[model samples]
Target: MHLSVSCGIPLIAPCRSSVKLPPPSPGIFYGRAREIDHIIDLVLHKSPARVAILGPGGIGKTSIALTVLHHPDIQTIYTHRRFFVSCETVTTADGVVLELLTTFGLIHDPQQGILPQQVLLNHLQSLPGGILCLDNLETLWDVETRATEHLLTTLASFSQLTLLVTTRGSRRPMHVAWTRPFLAPIMPLSLDAALQTWDAICEVHNEYSIKLVHAVDCLPLAVTLLANLAESESSKMLWERWEHDKLEVLHTQDSDNRLSNIEFSIELSFRGPKLKDDVQTVQCLSIICMLPQGLHESRISLFADAYSQVLPKFRSSIALLQGLCLVYSSDDGFVRVLSPMRHYIQAHHPLPDHLLSQLANIYCDISLAVH
Candidate 1:
């Protein structure tokens, strides 16, 4: 049966099929109420809600998407039709289509002469409507841009279907009219939210906890890791370890998963297609990571002039870094890396001495100009 509204109320009943739903919303989520509400409103009230939740690695994009999927209002409308597919392991358009078929139990039969994509499309067409959450879509899109966009365009053709995507980086996949007032890339948690999360995890609220969160720039994953450590180690000891180890200490003992390890999370971005082999971009990022404050936007020309050899492609490199969510531009016009990312980059990818000298000379010129 199709979804219908009566008296401005949705009269659609939940699907009765026995398909298993995604896991419940996170047990200890905090600091994302506004985002959750916005996504819910769009899915329930807007037409063709093709929402892309983009952000850096470990920024809780998947968690936010999961919360929206399991939301009461969402459950009422899209019930058994909701599908959450992880594109984390797939690397091609065909791979994504295969994932969709697998999620829907529509195994392709070569003897039946039906393409996998067509099988998925036919299955969805039979349903009233549904929401598809493609988590970590960048794995496919970054590698096979053209074919992936074609697949997205075809998927977007379904007027009844709503698409929710969570991917690393600030850029959304092209070929769809994503909901207006585009959701900016998710930022670090507010101080209060960070502290609340810390206290909830470790049952402690003190100066060391406050300093610990700030030291990680209030990034949720980093805060969560350090808090987990706080459960066993004293807050003071954690802080002292942080002072020495930085991102190294932001992982659980003997665990290195991206969610639990801040360094692994940053490594994913650093080794992403955008920044992996781009020497100039890597150099630019290393410089930003070393800067105590950040590289100001206005200083681009000065830096370009001073470090002409290293920054030959300075502007594009900066854009690439921002697109990957490795660095961000603040309201103060300075582009900065998050503390966890800065620590990771500094420890693993330190700039060469000659390049550092060039950066220092530019700073010297800027200081002289100010005086």
Candidate 2:
């Protein structure tokens, strides 16, 4: 495909039959060539558009965006001046506008100590159109629902600029004129894809294929972490220990303050304040585990009421389960937990000892009461 030099728009294929792919970067880019193609179309297509790639955290949203923007066979339109803004730091919509103005070397003095939406609109209208990348787009919205939506709507309507956003939030206002992938699977690696990943890892770490896959769970972050870990220990020995306690080791909190990569990710999920009845909650989940694969929810509910003595809000329990990424709410309002329970039930990071004692006391009280 050829590109228009003056306007930076991608043009018709010079030789319709022979399509060439750009050279890929050597870093940790995984699946999603198809998603990247759509993104390239949005940004380099002959019109202005807003593109968004939305998905779960640590799921390679940023990596995929970088791949399209940096492709060596890529058109030079965006690379000349791609503005990378981290939306996580700038706290408000006004701040986001100010940040852009400052980055572009424009006079950024807010007229009345606050930027009017039109002022931003006019400024963007004045500047030479460029690709504006906003990562973690859902962050900085705070609790102001309307303000976030309003800013998004205004940004998407910019006359000449192309905006690409990476977020884990819903795509509503930002969905205006853009085209990007809407689905949210990690896009599982195919056999060819798997070989590509293993070859990439083996080139550096010299590990066997199947053993590496087993240790890392085949996720990009997991593979990267374990590949680095292989420099210190033989892959065989590591796999042996990992087989014994894979989930626990994945969140290995004691490894020199270094996140054993993917294990470090779960740390974010643990940041909020601990549950008030955490001891009982842990106990409740453990009891639920003892049941069969197709365990009944009513049975679990009855055990929760009996053992905890206090009836917990079913909603709170459901929210906790969701936050753990362990369970999903079914159509019938039942909760289905995800695989591999030993991490929660028998892992080192158990509920507080005090909470455990309190849970035991509650169970004894309930038992006596039942008699």
Candidate 3:
């Protein structure tokens, strides 16, 4: 049974005239050609590509999704069937159905005795081989887990439909067999790509420009924000301000969008359901943020001893932080926060003095043992 919609209600054709257009292609995209190509291949070749682009906030998930939505081959295959739904403001499973209905130009008339989900499913059944892109789906998935799962499971059952989603954090919603060899969560851009993005914006390739990109760890949003600042503010001055201001230096006075403000973007993750009320996890993150070299996995036991009263399950706390994309394991086996995130944590949520002293003593003991 492709759809469960009853034959009693008249199936409505999608009103093309009222359909909303997808956002314009990201004008200055870089470093994601491989990801885009892989996604295209999955959607084009696979029976029903159920792909999720997962990552932390401000890491270019939306930009990559938008770029794929506008790809030439994707445009040729999906045509007007392509629907891009921004789930940033949506928080419920029903809300997702409504967004899809709105995107399809179908009016939900409760008086007609049709469930909105049925209306949506019926409409989708009418249009075969369509692609749906849900951007920033974490807003919905985090708050309404079971409901969202049921919704996605139902959607994935349509073998002719392709489902693509972008969400903050490292996990995709469960129950759906996402395409094999799942796409890894997006990471910070490479130095080369970061420099290209910087030069494109500021047009000044110098020592300071190189230093600026490195300072932000080549995060796309951070690079773009700082590059825009570099256009008017001298690189030297901006570098100095970065030392004092950190994320504040990347803010745009005129805009409140998370993408335009590094602080706001980090705050969203900090305030997400997983971390927002979890004091021990925040403190654990602060400890990692305080150490430039990061907290080694082996040393977590020592830190747990230091804060045993406050952080009884320190190992799980660190695991939660990593799962949330707040801290990552470095190539050197240390768990490190990105430079921009480190600065934000230090300035706004520094470790308590007593805990800092304990950590200092712990490190001092390690050094003494080494000698």
Best by lDDT: 3
Candidate 3 lDDT over residue span 325-360, tens digit each: 888887788998888888888888989998798788
Clashes of 2: 0
Instruction: Score residue 280 of candidate 2 by CA lDDT.
Output: 44
lDDT of 1 by residue, 282-334 (tens): 88889888888898888877776776775699788889889988889899999
CA shift at 183, candidate 3, in angstroms? 0.4
Tell me which of candidates 1 and 3 scores higher on TM-score: 3
Each candidate's lDDT (Cα)? 0.81, 0.52, 0.85
For candidate 2, write residues 166-219 as lDDT tens digits. 764333343265553343333334434544665576554334545656434355
After superposition, the stretches of candidate 2 with alpha carbons farther than 4 Å from their true spots are 1-26, 44-47, 72-74, 107-120, 142-145, 169-185, 188-195, 204-212, 244-260, 269-371
Worst 10 residues of 2 by lDDT: 11-20
* After superposition, candidate 1 runs with Cα above 4 Å error: 1-20, 253-256
Which regions in candidate 3 have their CA more than 4 angstroms from the true location?
1-17
Q: Would you list the rank order by lDDT, best first?
A: 3, 1, 2
Local error of candidate 2 at residue 326 (angstroms): 7.1
- Clashing residue pairs in candidate 1 (N, C-alpha, C atoms within 3 angstroms): none
Q: Residue 197, candidate 2: how far off, in angstroms?
A: 3.2
Q: After superposition on all CA atoms, how large is the RMSD of candidate 3?
A: 2.3
